[model samples]
Target: MMMMLNNEESEIVKDEKSPCEKPIKLIELSEKPRVYRIPNFLSDEECTHLIESSKNKLRPCNEISSGVHRSGWGLFMKEGEEDHPITQNVFKKMKSFVNLTDSCEVMQVIRYNPGEETSSHFDYFNPLTTNGSMKIGLYGQRVCTILMYLCDVEEGGETSFPEVGVKVKPIKGDAVLFYNCKPNGDVDPLSLHQGDPVIKGTKWIAIKLINQKQQPSNNNNKEGSCAP
Candidate 1:
């Protein structure tokens, strides 16, 4: 079980235990639909590999708006047979930790240069009006989002969920996990979040958006199945 070390007004503190040997230090950013942070979720070697492999494939973050609101170089890695061991291991850890049979969407690698910023946005897409593909087995909706930090920032670049008063700084090898929808399957407004502007240094990160799994399970998996 995940150990809740303490509960503060704005955040919950704990050291989350995973299926893997490595223990994670968690900070609960929200309660409803759950938002938590996992320190040291990846190794330095893994972070370096992810950044190097996706560097050449980088492109502007938002194709439509371009560099107006959010400006950055980004790349994506989709699931396939041919994947690096580190990449595959990441998938395995996420899958096992979340207890989800449904696969993840294409992993996104994003880098924010100084002065670049992303406006606040909610992650869950409307089921009826959504245009993008959400299917990957039983996942018709985006349930969980797991973000990993590839590099540390020297100044700004903090992820904020304003409604919950949560702000997480980019820490190398750490991860932030949250749910887009509530237990009732409705999009939670509290899930609204934003990537604060990078002031002085560059920010490197990876995103794994997980869809709902189709398999039936008695496991009551909330965000991540880690016990603190």
Candidate 2:
């Protein structure tokens, strides 16, 4: 369908499904690491709201090699991911895209400036490597990540998957998704990815990680108290 806007248009009705939340058309970008990309995931309004909520609380990102500061978007965005009307609405909407309702990590908002970039890393846990282990999740495993682009970059800032030779550009409202583990719960090394250096303009993004929820253990057993 062609998207056209005219001055005579009074109001544009929103679609039932988000521009990028179509579950049926979930495209697979990689099979080894189970990567996917959904175009136009978030809307322009949603992106702006998230950025506004965390504009003042940005902090310097931690880097191992050089504890010194790097020239990133300088906007380490966060907040409004919880207890906000817009957040609740979007969180509930995301439920329609994947299972495991009680299994999402806090949403993270991040911005990157030209020449800034993050090192390659894996989101899932691995028992073999010290750096690959995840110790602070309330779940079994990190499953999927829904990364949305808040704004566009003029030159660079593509999401690069070096292992699979994939690089996704930063387009406002689009999203990149990928699984960190296989069906049997083993971490996939092919999922390794990193934020490529930004070349020209500022790059804004929001990321949410989904995990396998830890099943509540029923340790206590009780006798039947119900009436027959």
Candidate 3:
């Protein structure tokens, strides 16, 4: 069960026990979609820094090989890697808002330009495993994903979830927080989302933070990747 209590309303979302069961709310986009958008989630200065840093990391790729042609930016946080300052701060804030038990890792920073959009897909992490041991299943667990919009979009660039019929446009300094997996570690099918094509200007952005364990487990793999 996921609960959010505020002065206006207390939101409690219950996950289905079976992995094959469909999400309860089908018509409403916001109802139990596991997606939350927070406007002005980052400061103006912080947003600018993230954009600059990510721009310097962009990598050219073969567009024709894939369905779309787009560039990518990435930064990984290992045990001793220099962490992105913004990502470190956001991770701390996220811990307070949600219940997390394991150490979190910084995955990648991604940006999409005009005519670029990610196809619908689900974010999945490898099942927890110890050193050369059998994988310890942590199915249906919730994995946190945070996206901070670095640049504003004029038109046609929106994050859309076709399963729930939800579309979120890019707003500078705002962030969208979502859970990639469900309470039982089963990846939520309704959470499948995609980036709409950028018709006007380039879509600049950065993603900060990934999963933190909510309970002690033997799982070791903790890397995350994204496509634009």
Candidate 4:
């Protein structure tokens, strides 16, 4: 099911969905270079609830560093795994907004504290097997990323695509969706992004969407490696 926000009431405008219907006007950001703001994407109550849930479920900051070689907060979910009800609902809504399928997975939930930032990097285009080798023909291409900001930042901590000179601030209940790969399965250079260091209070949280269906193979193993 898909829902729209009235923008005025700041309430969730629910829309009944047919079995396989997709949401409308889920704009493609890669095709354009602008932030598509959906005001009140989550209601005030929903935002409060999510904050509480995150606080309750907060894992050690070191856990997130283990994955991205950066200091931050993170929680992971397998391709089809649905653990938390709140997270599941958020993921479903995101998928509906982009018309994503089961192949596109909710990879992680991440938060950045003051002074934390990820160096600019492009997502690897291939998936590594359990044995550390690249999947033969099953390399997963990252299509788009849905970064739903869960809290307001006091300063700094904007998601910056330096290559394109674009910066996105953290806004509660607002999502910044962008394409990381071209339709032809090429990684877009402009998608190289970094989390600017938070200068004041903690930057709170965001979601990283990984689309596995469009990933490429580690043919050369030249620049992009799947290892930590």
Highest TM-score among the candidates is held by which one?
1
Question: What local lDDT does model 3 show for residue 108?
Answer: 49
What TM-score against the true fold does each predicted structure earn? 0.79, 0.74, 0.68, 0.67
Off by over 4 Å in 3: 1-29, 61-86, 99-103, 126-142, 212-223
Q: How close is candidate 3 to the true structure, as a TM-score?
A: 0.68
- Candidate with better lDDT, 2 vs 4: 2
Q: List model 1 lDDT by residue over 33-126, tens digit each.
A: 5888877889888899889888887777766222135677776553442168888777766754564453345577788889886777766655
Overall local distance difference test of candidate 1? 0.69
Task: Report lDDT (Cα) of residue 181, candidate 4.
Answer: 66
Clashes of each: 5, 3, 12, 3
Tell me the spans in candidate 1 whose CA falls farther than 4 Å from its real position.
7-19, 64-68, 78-82, 100-102, 128-139, 214-228
Model 2, range 1-228, lDDT digits (tens) per residue?
A: 212234332222233465334432345666677776666667678889988987677654552123233344333222334668776656665665665344455566677888987777777655565533443233446677778888999999998889989888889978777887887887788888888889999988877777677444331111110000
User: RMSD, each candidate, Å?
Assistant: 6.5, 11.3, 8.7, 7.4
Preferred candidate (TM-score higher): 1 or 3: 1
lDDT of 3 by residue, 12-69 (tens): 3333341212211111226555777665656687777766755665554333224433
**Models sorted by lDDT, best on top:** 1, 2, 3, 4
